[model samples]
Target: MTTEIATLGGGCFWCLEAVYQELQGVQQVESGYAGGHVANPSYEEVCSGGTGHAEVVRVTFDPAIVSYREILEIFFTIHDPTTLNRQGNDCGTQYRSVIFYHSPEQEETARQVIAEMANVWDAPIVTELAPLPAYYKAEDYHQNYFRQNPLQGYCAFVVAPKVAKFRKIFADKAKSA
Candidate 1:
């Protein structure tokens, strides 16, 4: 199976990281900051929105098991891409909807998915489709956060709901632990 990378910023990386980690073809999901100006910006720097980075998850997946289109399908369904730079109570540039395409094919695929979602949803799709940027890895605690802190406040309240939705919508994609 060929390997490909898909960088997506839909909201908090922890939420996205948790869901993707459970997917069948997804090998790794690293929480990081992308579409930013500064290099290697700290998590705090990104939170302040001064670095212009969005909290993104870098997903390494096997194309044979899961198509890039399917990944994008999950991405659009789990988060509201219509809102600009915001998700739920989290409002900032860091929480914006963005697709950081690693290659031209990825770029086109991302755009096509957005178009598909737009046709299905009543509201226009506002998800940003951009070229891959220098992705600065997030802080240590942010990685695999939902698994490590499942009962933690944010994980239980926010992360869990997204995970449930993903599971319900894509039960076939779930990878046995």
Candidate 2:
């Protein structure tokens, strides 16, 4: 199967990772750091806001099953793109809304999607669009965090709601459990 990569940072990587993991076409969702100059930054370092990295998820998906636009549509729905450098209580540059496109086509699609979403939201869309940069996979514990820690406080209150919303709003797109 043909697979494409989409790197996105909407808030906590756990939230994005959890939602994307449930999407039908997704083959793998890796929590990671991107849009930074540092080499192989640790989660703690990125969280400090000193590494310039955003908490991002590298999603590998089959375009034949789910188009890039559809993935972007879900992203816009699941996170508050208007809130700069934060999503809910999560704060810092690492928590900013961003899309790191892997190709020219992806970049163009992101621009169009963001423009359309601007009309849908009352506030302006603040999601950053940039070419994909060096990406560092997060620590092992971070991968599939929600699935592994469903009862964890942050996973329960924060990530679970986003996952439920994704399932509720895009039931047809969700993978069968």
Candidate 3:
């Protein structure tokens, strides 16, 4: 199977990781850091907002099963792109909405998707679009955080809702349990 990668940061990486993990064509979803100046930043360093890194997820998917545009559509639905440097109570530059495109085609698709989504939101879309940069995988404990810590406070209260929203809104695209 052909695999394409999409790196995205929309609030907490846990939330985006949880939702993308359930999408049908997504082969792998890795919580990570990107769009930053630092090298191999730790989660705490990123959270401090000094490393310039945003909490991001590197998603590997099969384009034949799910197009890049469809992946972007789900992304827009699951997160508030209008809120700059934050999603809900999560704050800091690390929580900003961003899309790190891997190719020219992916960049074009992101631009088009953002433009279309702008009409849907009353506020302007603030999601950043940039070419993919150096990505550092988050700590081992962070991978599949929601699946591993479903009852954890943040996972339960925050990540779960995003996962549920994706399931409810895009049932057709969700992987079978």
lDDT of each: 0.91, 0.96, 0.95
Provide the TM-score for each candidate, comma-separated.
Answer: 0.97, 0.99, 0.99
Instruction: Please report the candidate that would top lDDT against the real structure.
Output: 2
Model 1, 64-140: lDDT tens digits are 99989999999998999888889999999999999999889988888788877998777878788889878888989
Cα distance off (Å), candidate 3, residue 63: 0.4
* lDDT by residue (tens digit), candidate 3, 1-177: 799999999999999999999999999999999999999999889999999999999999999999999999999999999999999999999999999999999999999999999999999999999998899999999999999999999999998889999999999999999
Candidate 1 stretches with Cα past 4 Å from truth are: none
Residue 33 lDDT (model 2): 96
lDDT of candidate 1 vs native? 0.91
Error of 3 at 70 (Å): 0.7
**How much RMSD separates candidate 3 from the native structure?**
0.5
Error of 3 at 113 (Å): 0.3
Candidate 2: stretches off by over 4 Å: none
Model 3 misplacement above 4 A = none
Give one clash count per candidate, in the order shown. 0, 0, 0
Worst 10 residues of 2 by lDDT: 40-49
Tell me the RMSD of model 2 versus the true structure.
Answer: 0.5
